[model samples]
Target: MKEIVQINLDNEMDLILAHKRCMKIAEMCGMASSLQTRFATAVSEVARCAIAKGKDSLLVLNINIIKATQKEITAIITDNVDLKSCSPDAFIYASKISHHIEYQYSNNQSLTKISLPIPSPGLLSETKIKTLIDYFKFETPLSPYDEIRKKNIELIALSEKLAESENKYKQLANTIPILICVINERNNVLLVNESLENYLDKPLLSFDRKTLMNFIHTEDIDGILEGWNKAKQNRSNFLGETRIKKDSNYIWHLISIVPNKTEDGSFNSWLVYFVDINAQKMMVETLKDNTQLKLIQHELENANSKLRFKNKELEQFAYIASHDLQEPLRKIMIMLSRAGEHLSEDQKKKYYFDRITSAAGRLSNLITDVLNYSRIENKEQYFEKVDLNKIIIDVLGDLSLVIEEKHAVINVNPLPTVFGLDTQLRQLLYNLINNALKFNAKQPSVKVLHENVPKDEHLPIGAENYEVIAISDNGIGMDSKYSNRIFDMFQRLHERDQYGGNGIGLALCRRIIENHNGIINFTSKPDEGTTFWIYFPKNKLYTAKLSLKNQSSN
Candidate 1:
């Protein structure tokens, strides 16, 4: 016996989980949909009863060979509380639905096992069983709400497909050899094509929905009935695969139900098709076995990427809460405590109060910057052809006051128009130019230049050329070792009092450049001026637009 999934039945959600796993295992074992639902329903009933009457309830799904040509998918539900002292309703129900049921009472616990026979035991070969085990071990379970949503989405897609050729359904049903039938809202047979009558070996109008179920394999009856019930409730189309009996043998068919609606959009009847898909089903089985491991690897990669991104964001927030936000808060608290000692001295008391107000203002600014940094990922930003020269002019205008105070000399060369977010591009230039004015020993002289270079390792992958923009300033530069660390959130090389602004500016600058699918790097030395290089893929118009749209959707 090989274990597939184990669930602790504690609540209604856990029951749903157990049922879903049971259904999946049955499907993977090459059991038809009819059998899958029967097995799942039996497990769910047993689990529900255990949850209500037992303690420490657990449901374990596994597979075991019964004979030379037959195997069974077994669900073993055990509870620490003895079901012999409770109710036998679930066990009685399971015995009727499953191929076999076994119940044993030992000590204070009760164990119930439900087994559903698999006709194609070869599907559960040793290699396939190991694959199933590995797949389930790494699989993330979907919530009940997600499962419902997924079903609704599938139903909607099927409905759309049906609607595409709905006007010609009658003509096609009569002309083609495919088995087709029509049933009223009450599931009474209204019409049947000659193909359907010939296939069933019964005359038209002699069969209703109930009679149709008789021709379907017992394993499939519950599933088709459930699909019909759901379709009637939603007045939507339904599609499922099942095995239908022809004479004494059963063959796989794709069953589709297209609901007929009145002009007011109320459902009146259903047009159903029984498409023989046995050959396609066999092909799908072979393909699935070969591709299952690859699909699992792809899913695992996507999940890991998303998890890493979320973890990085969480680390940033944690760092701010633990370190950045603490300094100003601590200073405010200390100033308030010192203020009490100088109550008799008005000047000293006022001085302490002023310092407290300054600390509070700094704290508020830090919070705003942090929020803005976070919003870079969430803001609804659109990309267009952005003129770098215009961005520089706007940023310089915003810093005109600072430029005058520092007696700055600004030299700007003609820059190219690039595809990017306009507002973020403006912010990027503002931060870089503003930093040029702020971090200066004597006079501030800044130059903005642009160049075009052939593709190289420094450019984005698969790029034809690079559009490079350089912003150099005569300012107090830093050690080259701190270049990368400076781009981290709340990272600063200088003391708080030395720099007038928070350390989030460079981090935001880096994020903005990244959002544009570009790179920002710099060369610096202590006392010498720093030159920041911005590289954008020259032929990235289409790529950047598509990448930006994908990022926005995510």
Candidate 2:
């Protein structure tokens, strides 16, 4: 058996890094992707449980060779939580994924161990194990404070090497692809590469720190200085992009400066490298321009589409108005003209006058319904918190006379407070109630009920909680074949002379419900009562705002 690595299960980030390391090691051991994922998941679950339920938990990994041909990878998670008090489901899941699992408890501490057997012809040779051990020896589990101290020691040793390699650096810099320079503690240029000299077309020995700043673009001077100062203070690397003057034009370059520190943790100097990235920057700018052009073209197409739709709607409205509205007025005019010329008895005149009056009434109703439908499209309504019960009561009060005339009996259940346009909701209720009473033959019995419902495939996207409001009425209903057609503008199943309607009531109701991000449908049969179901989203206010934003953007 050989110890591989250990990690402290302290926080969420640590747990995440631990799992990543486990997966990486499993991959190095020639494990398949599925097996690697299983090991990582099992390690994460055990480590998370240990961190949540216990204190000072540690996760250890090891490799053991069996029969000189097979290898087994194991993880041991130790915590202070009592074994009996721990979650059983987590271990059971781990057991299913792993080959073997065991729990050990003693001296107020508990250990959960999981192992997976590797396929034959294991990849963990002696040389590979040595490399892994050497790479991870200093990376063993340590307190955060100890880790910082170790990093500081490494930095100090690197500083000594930088000071001693002046000649060797000069020889190596000439062959590198990037331009390199060294800046001393006093912020003066100590040395520069041949590449830098060739690019600037000047001798490195003649230029100083101030001369170098003159070559950088004026807009980027402050930003570059700020990044440099921050890196100096933190004893870290500074990375930035800026334009540098070359010949008569400016070109982009990526600057990277690595700080060298003294043994006492003080700043020594910076080793800076300049990488030419003008081609990459130009490509990015070109792509951005193309993307912007595509977006503008898409917007133009959307605008054209909307214009076409609006024009079609206007044409249909004009056709309907010229035919439907004028027909009634034409009949009235012809009837009155005949009555005036005949000069008959009172009964004959009364018959023609009544016909004229009925024609005029139908014309008036057509105009009113058209105006109401048009208002629904053109007017912008404000949404607010509305009580359904209050709206129902108000509607009932308004239709009290008609209800009494029909002897209609309405049963209302407790309703909910929903977000909607107040006036529109009231109009919707009024239309539905009036239609139920007008079409009924016997004593009209209507039931209004509402209840919360789950989200289903029928609900619109972004709908979370919904309310289904059903209005059932014992009225003369139409055939089921006209279910979808009933909501169309001026679509009347019954003849106007019999039903006494312009066919805009249901259409208007449909539009109002749609504006609130809801859907309306009904079930009806000839002689059977109709039950209209309206599905209203509880969070209509949010969806409404989103809709407005989308429209405005388009």
Candidate 3:
């Protein structure tokens, strides 16, 4: 009698196929056909259990078919499983079927089967039982680490995905647009993107440190050196404007080379993004030429020529208007003087001829102010070192009549020797000091002082040397609203007959300060004094006196 071979099936599909093939083979070996069909039924039941509880694992079943005598075969099958969770009725039902089968296997796996096959009556004939027993005696059970093998497979899949992503990141870095370049801290080229290859018309691998500097323009070499030195010393990002030679043409580029630092605050490399700024540079050059520009004498001459033509027209008009009106005003004044001689005391009281005489005199004064204001600028003249103290003294002497009339106090401080036209500075002092004297309230107290400004006491608006001269006065102060208008010509805040003068004084002051390339601003309040501060920039106008000082000392 031959022994039936032992067979181990890993999973449900393997077990079902193996059982089908063995059943067909067992019947040919003279085993009962009905009992072979019973073995197929049992294998199908185990397959359902394997599918329900095993996600990535499988069910293992061992089967043995034995032949004891011709036409007698018995099968013994074992499955590695547990069924503690099955219902009591199901267990009772399976136990009943186990008693009827020639060889019984328990349904202990997680799945529930609808039916268990019963062996045909007298079908097995006890031939397969002996064969199945011999199969179990030679084989051992499989180990449990088979499930851990699946976990290792999943880990390898994740590792492969991570590697793919890293490669993609490097690929994108080498292909992005803009003039991308990576350089080491020593300014050695590390990588260049494909967009830069398109611009250079060369392959990326050909770009290296050996030929990099040769592409830069010679005129920008020094500036580029200074920028690189600053980056290395400061360990900071370098941004500069430079030109490059490409295909025998120069292109301006704004390069932002930022250092990528190591952990210890030292740079290991740099990232550069170059932007073409040639169009913007050319636009700036065009705008500079368009402005009526340059400190050159020719442009100044052109400006002076325009001013001379306008001034000539204005002076002639003022002279003619003043001459024609003065003649009629003289005749009216002479006739009024004679009329006063003829009228009696009562008639003189009825007629006010003095009003007409004063009105004509005011018109004449306004005309004179308009003429002087229009012709204030002498563009043909040059600045010279002039004693401003002498100018102030002359102004004080010119207004001596008013000082005596009000018994007003006046103080003149030592002034600087500034380089300016004497005519302009003289007019500046005359207008400002006269306003300080004329605007006083009942107390007619006026003081003029000058002092040197300290170097650091300035908020520089532009690049220039400035001297701050504060002209303080004790006058009838003005409010904020009227203070700005007081400098405008013919914009008087009070009636002329009351304040007693033409309003061109402050207007003339503003124009004179402007002609000297200076600014005149003031601070005032109601019932408080006013202080006008003049900011005169130091130029040939102010520094020429230094040479005179040394020569005087010698």
Candidate 4:
């Protein structure tokens, strides 16, 4: 007698769940360790095939018993899954591969060889086998479809062709002296190519199908099981890294398992390959220990800032990197403006220049912004306590000339003091004000509002004090879609001439806020004014908030 069960789980996680459910049954059945392991491998192969084929489908499984002196379990699983155009025969042929097990007898005698055909994907071995053990009865063979044989030949031919193309693989394996062996789902060694002897360093019998798993490194056992389980249920190949214990140490190897199935969809065996990557592993360790080399890339921002220090020396450097990018930009603006000037009384070039100049100017600005953004932290800068209101007032006063020229309406409120570099804060306020006024074609209205929400602020609570500095504006609002990237350097939502400034302003603001051990984020909407909220935390080592602003304001 045997038990039969079937399940159809769609999600990858669901497949994992089903596999676990099956393993639990095997444990409950109190089956022999070897047989329990075999059951697990059987369930895994079928489950893998189910997920890999697509469209969350169900697997139908039939379980039966073969009885002589002892009872042996047999199962046949099938799926009604409609798959994409592929050779059904190929999948079936891959599954038909049988596994050989040399069983251990309790008496002081010899072992017996047993050939067990593994179950197909989906049905959990624990469920069916335990059910079979619970109600034992004799039954005829639950034979597989005979017609699948015709397709198996075709599948074998195709698989051989696939493997044959790797004609150089064996030669390379031999030259490298790498150990490569293929094992069945039960971890029974089906075949070990000539190149594999080097790693095993043992006789062929020691690494045969019966004892194949013993050679696997203890730490890698779980990983191998995981990958195999995934492949069994989902119908996929497993490739991963593991270690093989040798002389009390581990030798790392990259192991791969590919499933070959028969035409009737019986998993035949696994094709595994291994490669020794000791040199690469050593290189990784060397880099991990090199502190200076590790920090160099992160410090590139500092180097770039020094490169952009308004020096005549770097003008040529930037010229080389950007490569005369500004020239074409200037020429386009000139040509467009000139063409507009030369047009007849009826025609206007300002309209055309708006689009062309905007495009060229935006491109030029993007290049400049990228270079400048990369250079901000390269140069040394000091930090101090800064009064937010003063920075706003200073920027407002600086732009007073432009404000009056454009008849812009300005609204301001008192702001709190923060610990940060003055120049950055001033720059932050300037960009906010600039972006606000620049994007507006009508009214030219701008309002700067401040709020203090220190403790209520969403900041990493690692310091004594936390301050939230919100810089909200009332102007032609930006789209909320760009709210996330509004702080990204070179990311502009409008034309350059339409809003004349490098887009690095917000990005710089973010860097400054982060340097102060603070957070910076935004909330905005299309046609609704945007608000950039910056957080500042008071800590001894991280004091980026206000000194520069205080000194300048004082």
Candidate 5:
């Protein structure tokens, strides 16, 4: 192989140089003028293809010997273009005029080799090749004016083709409903489609970035700006969902930005597209509203259920109150009437008077218990840190007389400070301890102990971290079947005459515990002792309808 000349095929001027160089080389190799023109035109066609599809295109003229009596002139065009995407026309015309043409691609580049057999191979030798190479090295290139004139002509032809393509693209853009815009690297609006103008109902007068942002909704402006800036900085494609203003209302749009790069891979411009998504967004919002409506309906139903339960409780309390109060009052009246009738029998009258007094006291106690139960509904009380040990001491002091009468032995253990109404908690312990003493047959023995229970215990109430207080007593216990029923108002397992209670104490105790967000349960056997467990959440502070001022008042 022998090399002659190489020309860079960058612009139309370079294209002219590549053609001229090929013709000159062919003439020196003993080719006719007509054949020279044909070969040069073929080389120019392939070189033009290289310029359009790839960058840094080069045209090389060389001579190669095929056999002992054969030599050929070859034109090799190389560029950074993938062969798969390059047009076959790049080689078709060149192949027809040239003896043979070969195409190869590698490393993201294409090489087109076009060869034409020299008519007189014998005239071409090492000496002749040297002459041709020297002729190109010293030959004066095209004058500056001629170069510019040829470039102008090329630009005119290119501009005509670009105008045709732009017209077609504008027709398509205007027919579509999407809003399209082209912006430069500085974010200045370069062009906008007819659809954008029609949507805004006016032509865009300003080409600045701020002017374009005015069309976006105020709430969505920051997000849109941030996304655009990030995509511009990275010179990459971007997609964002935002609300754009239309007339007085805001509509959702999906904005897509595609970047255009120059030959050197630098950002040149950005193509932005806005697609209406208001319909989809509205559908999503409607579904969300329906879900929230369902949740509110469920909450209302639960509140109604609780109200109905409370109403039933009130009805039961009314019936029982009338029966219990009338019984005591009737007995007192009957005893009084008997005492009056047997006025002469001093001993019988004295027995009737005692029976009247006992009945009256029972009635008084029943009224006092009823008042205590009703007081639990008062929500004015506030919560504070209550020491359980102090509560137990106070309850003991109040029940000291009963404890002495029963000769009960009580054991105390250290307890933790909890959050609750002090007065309510004191009443709770008082009722439990009083029951412990009252229900016992033998000498009463009670133990108060405390421990921490973990959330994983899965207690009957639920699994939650709790501070548990166990109050066990060596007292006669009731049937386990009454455990749940005993908490009801006016419910009692034992005979009222034997227990001497109106049956409101345990119910009051349960209510107080509930107000403090705590749980109380007991385990007992008929002959053995009973163990009452009270659990308070370790981390929670219970307060019912606590106002800020009331909370501090405690």
Candidate 6:
């Protein structure tokens, strides 16, 4: 046997070169033209398969001489790739072209060999073989058939990839919340997701540009066109708010258009999405109406003005109350569902159950706070000479268990008596003391001090003197930036997980102080401590009358 040629099959060009060389070798062996074509076709197919599925492949051509009686031409394609994994179609095509085709595997290499036998008298002469060898020295022209086959394979692979991409696109568009539609450059709808069909109450197959335009509100057509034109000119996205007809009623919808362009920078299509914005639009309108109403009623009678303001405040409070309450209820439901799953595991069950219990306790506290806030003005008026010392003592007794657990110390500085509602004053002292104790990191020490401001000290009118009560505590204080915000309902400074409270303690105290015609203020530094000052006016006439009434009743 003699080696005719050896070529590395690394790419398409290498495969073509191998095929041409095989054909020329078969010709030089004096094989028939038909046999030459068959041998070359088989070599081309096998070489392509090896290059596509294998790594570092080589194509070898050899001459076989059997005892000077017979001569044969053979081509072998070998690579370090799995032969069983090669496409069956390539092997089938090669087998049809030549009966001497066979696959061999040895030394961890896959080899496909094809042989063409020459007749005894048809063996090539020495001169003709040398000429063929010289021809092989130059590059061979690519076979048209092989070129077509390569193109066909590429097209098949590309088609499969495109189909996969289309499937993923459909899945994403249908699963998302927004309505999606694809439109071609001719203004014709090409595809729409199920969301669009559901929104229109009709199948998308029956929709076109005209049909879609009919469903849009008449006033929005010009705006939509203007936005679309701008998007096209700038090659950017278009966004606008419009109304679309659904169930014979118009609803606000936000439309977003994303332009798709071809490689030549020409328009190809557009991707449009619709999002429902009726709730947001309605909220804006409601706020506008409320502002206008308030401005119109500002000059009304004092009684009516107060009533209107109170009504507005109640409305706002109701909105906030419902929203805040839902948070805890949602947590309770989620924890309960999780607890049901871990009922058999005692530790897991207890963990989730404790969370559910905490959420429920928070819900209860919020309801109680809201109830107390609402009843601040509804309580019967009962002003009397209330002793601050007695109120503080009662509050301390009520919180005795917490005080003991925290190892808290209480200091008093002769709090003066004042004319106010006894129950409100008791609640005010309780909240302030509880806040100081709850936020403390170390053993809490609280001081209750008071001083009487003389007449020249500038107090509210109709007051002989003002009693300023200062309650200071060593606790985990907060930044001064949130000093005013601390009195807002549901405005918590720390995360609920760190400091567990409903954020209503200070608000409740503020309300209670306001009912007694007093003002409350606070000062604090982070991690240091805080002090709350309450100013209560002393009205001589009211105190004297209340004292006389108390004497008569006794």
Error of 6 at 197 (Å): 25
Model 6 pairs in collision: none
The per-prediction tally of clashing pairs is: 3, 0, 7, 49, 0, 0
Predicted structure 4: clash tally: 49
What C-alpha RMSD separates each model from the true structure? 25.3, 32.9, 40.4, 23.4, 40.3, 25.6
Summarize candidate 3's per-residue lDDT along 199-277 as a digit string, tens digits.
7644444223335456667777677667766876887777898786678788888877677744233457777776666
On TM-score, the stronger of 2 and 6 is 6
What's the lDDT for all of these models?
A: 0.72, 0.70, 0.56, 0.54, 0.71, 0.71
Please rank every candidate by lDDT, starting with the best.
1, 5, 6, 2, 3, 4
The candidate 3 region of ten consecutive residues with least summed lDDT is: 542-551
lDDT of each residue in 269-358, candidate 2, tens digit only? 888888777655665565567666765566556656655664555545634543444544555445455544533445334223455457
List TM-scores for all candidates, in order. 0.38, 0.38, 0.40, 0.36, 0.37, 0.39
- Residue 402 in candidate 2, Cα distance off native in Å: 1.0
Score candidate 2 by TM-score against the native. 0.38
lDDT of 5: 0.71
Give candidate 5's error at residue 194 in angstroms: 80
True lDDT of residue 10, candidate 5 = 74
Clashing pairs in 3: 66-131, 72-127, 73-128, 74-127, 74-128, 74-129, 82-108
Model 3 spans with C-alpha error above 4 angstroms: 1-316, 341-349, 378-380, 453-464, 541-554
Query: Which candidate number maximizes TM-score?
Result: 3
Error of 5 at 126 (Å): 99
Model 4, range 391-416, lDDT digits (tens) per residue?
88789888887788778888777766
The 10-residue segment of model 2 with minimum total lDDT is 143-152
lDDT of 6 at 2: 68
Q: Please write out the lDDT profile of model 6 over residues 1-554, one tens digit for every residue.
A: 66778899888888767766776677666665446666777788888888788888888887766656677777888889865466789888789768998887878898788888877534565565567667778863554445434433332333344345446545544755567888765567788888787787555542234565767887888888788777767878998998988888998888999977542335688889887676556555655676656543443344365455645554456345544455545554454554355234453332234554565577667767776666566232577789998999899999999999999999988888887888888889999999889999899999998865455422334334457888999999889788757897777877777777777778888888777766777778888999997877676233221112223455
